[model samples]
Target: MQLEEIKETCPFCWSCIWLLVDPSFDQIYTEDCSVCCRPILVKTTISDNQITLTLAQEDDGF
Candidate 1:
């Protein structure tokens, strides 16, 4: 299975953003925060044909 895409609001400030996943499921990409213009770190994993996504503070030192 693959993480096709992410359709969720930004947890930081509730801004709408699109999180697209690569085919390899090793990386996630998204636009900068609309409210803060700050980058967002997206963490994801795929297992059993399911995708789990997590959004964290870009500067949270992942």
Candidate 2:
């Protein structure tokens, strides 16, 4: 699988950002914030061959 940074609109903050995507099974992968360089959590799913991604702050509980 290739790691690719894709441009996506932040669903929570409504901001534009780049997210890392592993082009297999459309799994949601999390990485340090590209803009703020902070930790984040990403949940993703695929339906109809379209990718849907959600981003949120990574809490210690997780």
Candidate 3:
């Protein structure tokens, strides 16, 4: 599978992290914040060789 490392700011800590993204499909997943150790919801969308990321507090409905 093709992978892309995307830099994103953690919503909880505002620290930067490199996220491994798959460009084959849209994805939603949870990951831990590296700096704050808080859960993060990552939403990814790929189009036209570009990746878009959206993050939120995990499962908090925020």
- The prediction achieving the highest lDDT against the true structure is 3
Please rank every candidate by lDDT, starting with the best. Answer: 3, 1, 2
Worst 10 residues of 2 by lDDT: 22-31
What do the candidate models score in CA lDDT, each in turn?
0.67, 0.65, 0.87
User: lDDT by residue for model 1 over 1-62, one digit each (tens)?
Assistant: 44366776776788777666654565555457667677777777767757777777777735
After superposition, the stretches of candidate 3 with alpha carbons farther than 4 Å from their true spots are: none
lDDT of 2 at 15: 66
Candidate 3 lowest-lDDT run of ten: 53-62
Candidate 1, residue 22: Cα displacement in angstroms equals 2.4
Error of 1 at 47 (Å): 0.6
State the TM-score for model 1. 0.64
State the lDDT of candidate 3 residue by residue for 1-62, as single tens digits: 97888899998889999888889888899988878899999988888978889999986643
TM-score for candidate 3, residues paired by index: 0.86
Worst-scoring 10-residue span by lDDT in model 1: 22-31
The alpha-carbon deviation from the true structure for residue 2 of candidate 3, after best TM-score superposition, in angstroms, is 2.1
Q: Sorted by TM-score, highest first, which candidate order results?
A: 3, 1, 2
TM-score of each: 0.64, 0.63, 0.86
What lDDT, from 0 to 1, does candidate 3 have?
A: 0.87
